[model samples]
Target: MSSKRDLIIQAAKQTFLKQGFEATSMDELALVANVARRTIYNQFDSKEELFNAVIIDIWKNVKPYRPEQNDEAQHNPSKGLFNLGMAIANYWSPPIVRSFLKLVIVEGDRFPDLPRNFYRLGKEPMIQSIFDYLTQMKHSHLLKIDDIGLATQQFIGMINEPLIGLGLIILSDEPDMQRKEHVVQAAVQCFINGYQP
Candidate 1:
């Protein structure tokens, strides 16, 4: 059983994904949610608040990378790095996420906080996870990195650009397993070459 707030959030997410933030209306959300318009207002002060909730909901739903949960990653730095890259790629590969990203890119000026909120909630944590892993690898002497943060950013850019630029932004064909493997492996190898002692 879903709570009224959950129902409203789910309904709004679907509407926003399909119609985008600028186009979606509170009335349409009310109709889709099967709740009175005032009900939404009772929960959220305004449409922006509702949209922010939806973005936070979506970010929450995306599987977070918890390296502590994976013992294998703790022991194997190379495998861990590859897994981190793959996790980011998988997170961004979802249609809903891609739709939200497109909406943010298109309407960022209208709602200036949308992109910042999304990055703070969604992207920052992922980067932090990778940074933590890199820090562990450095402590173990598996890699010699003077600046783990810069390396984390570079590694993410390497993996993200090819998949996101071609596959998502340019509307290229979905990358197959072979392509993903190659990209992840290449990213890990490049990171290792740069940092490995």
Candidate 2:
């Protein structure tokens, strides 16, 4: 990501956060980005294109990955599961993640295609990550999953159960540690109940 692109996405996020997706215009983005109107068009062809870019940028940043734990997990499988719970909990609790999610949910109906695109780019990666982790656990003989897909669903359900309500946006009430720890512990416990060998 170029610095300019980052600037544009940040500006878009601010614009979307303030004015929302429907009201935000390219001119507003340009003003916020401190670039010329033509500069915005040069980077993005249209408002819809700019929205897609901003949405992708946000999803990519919050994407879950386990590069740090992968090598260690080659020897210790349990650590991978623990790391995943922590990552998922932390990923969801971030203010930016919550903002993007709220934007998508709120504006999803106006742009019918947006929900599909966001689901593909955002949630699919998390599901695939959990599937891979479960596969590794099966391979390590630490867990026995009759069906990886179903197990993945269980993992996601546990992680997301608490976030199903609208209260996901109300972040100031709880300490960050407590919020994430509760999610992490719930996720790990549920996963183990279904996956323990």
Candidate 3:
């Protein structure tokens, strides 16, 4: 059973992804959600707020690595990084997430804050999680990372550019498990080679 709020958010996500923010209407969202328009107002004051909620809702489901929760990240840099890489690859490779990203990019010019909010609330936290994990590894002397920010971006780029970035531009088949593992492994090895103390 879905709560009215959940239903509204789900409807908003699909609608916003399919239609840009300016084009999407509260009435349409209510129709798709199978709720009255007032139900949306009860949950969110405005479309902008609902849009932020949609981004927040998506990230809420994502389980990013936390150093306290995952001790493996502290002791084994390679294994931890591979897990991180796979998580990033898997999350972004999905059609829904990609579509949401495309929506933000396309609508960014008209709704200037859309992309910023998306990044600040959604991607920034994920990036910061990785950055924090890498900082922990550095502090533990597990990896010799002088510049945590650059290293974090490098590892993420290695996984994302080949796997997700390419898909964003051209129609392409999703990489199989073997290919994903290869990319993660190569990234982990390259990171280890450069940063290992």
Candidate 4:
């Protein structure tokens, strides 16, 4: 049953990517999922809610790194910060997220509330996660400041600026690991530079 739900989500994602939100129908979603039309409603109350789920799924593999659970085998400040950078990279590099970027750019007006939902699931988690880690860093004297929210946006813009790409990401013929690493490295360094006392 869970697998069926996953399948429906995957199909919905593809459907949304291929056809803008305004064009996709529940019938099309059912066809792509290979499920009965009735089954989709059984699992999802509305297309909007289900679309929000599809967007959330793009970042599902990257869980929020809870320090209480994760600090058992932690390392120094630099290494810990670097790991967070890699996690951000991994979370945003997926094909699903890439398609999601396109949908946001092309269909921004069609689904008025989607941007809020996307930010709610995506940036909200990143903001809280960064705040938690920054609080720990604060106590350790690694960072000498408050105003985590503004700092959060700055660091995100650093690591994510290239990916932002005017709200689009273009995959080159070859995957560029060097380019990928550079964004994370620069973003992490930006935070360190600002916080160093």
Model 4 poorest 10 in a row by lDDT: 166-175
lDDT of candidate 2 at residue 125, scale 0 to 100: 80
Q: Which portions of model 1 show Cα errors greater than 4 Å? A: 171-173
Deviation from native of the Cα of residue 143 in model 4, angstroms: 1.3
Q: Give each model a TM-score.
A: 0.87, 0.80, 0.89, 0.81
Tens digits of lDDT, candidate 3, 92-112: 755766777778888899998
Ranking by lDDT: 3, 1, 2, 4
RMSD of 4: 3.0
The runs of at least 3 residues in candidate 3 whose Cα sits more than 4 Å from the true structure, single-residue gaps closed, are none
Q: lDDT for each of the candidates?
A: 0.85, 0.74, 0.85, 0.73
Q: Decide which is better by TM-score, 1 or 4.
A: 1
Per-residue lDDT for 79 in model 4? 57
The full ranking of all candidates by TM-score, starting with the best, is 3, 1, 4, 2
lDDT string for model 1 (1-197, tens) is 99999999999989987788889999999999999999999999988889889888877767757777788888787888888888877777666677787888788999888888778878888999999988998898878999988998999999888887755566555677788879989999988898988
Which should have the higher lDDT, number 2 or number 3?
3
Model 2 lDDT tens row, 28-96: 899999989998888888877787787787777676766345788655555676677666666666566
Candidate 2, which segments miss by more than 4 Å at Cα? Answer: 1-4, 60-63, 67-77, 163-166, 169-175
Each candidate's number of clashing pairs is 0, 0, 0, 0
Off by over 4 Å in 4: 1-3, 67-75, 163-176
TM-score of 3: 0.89
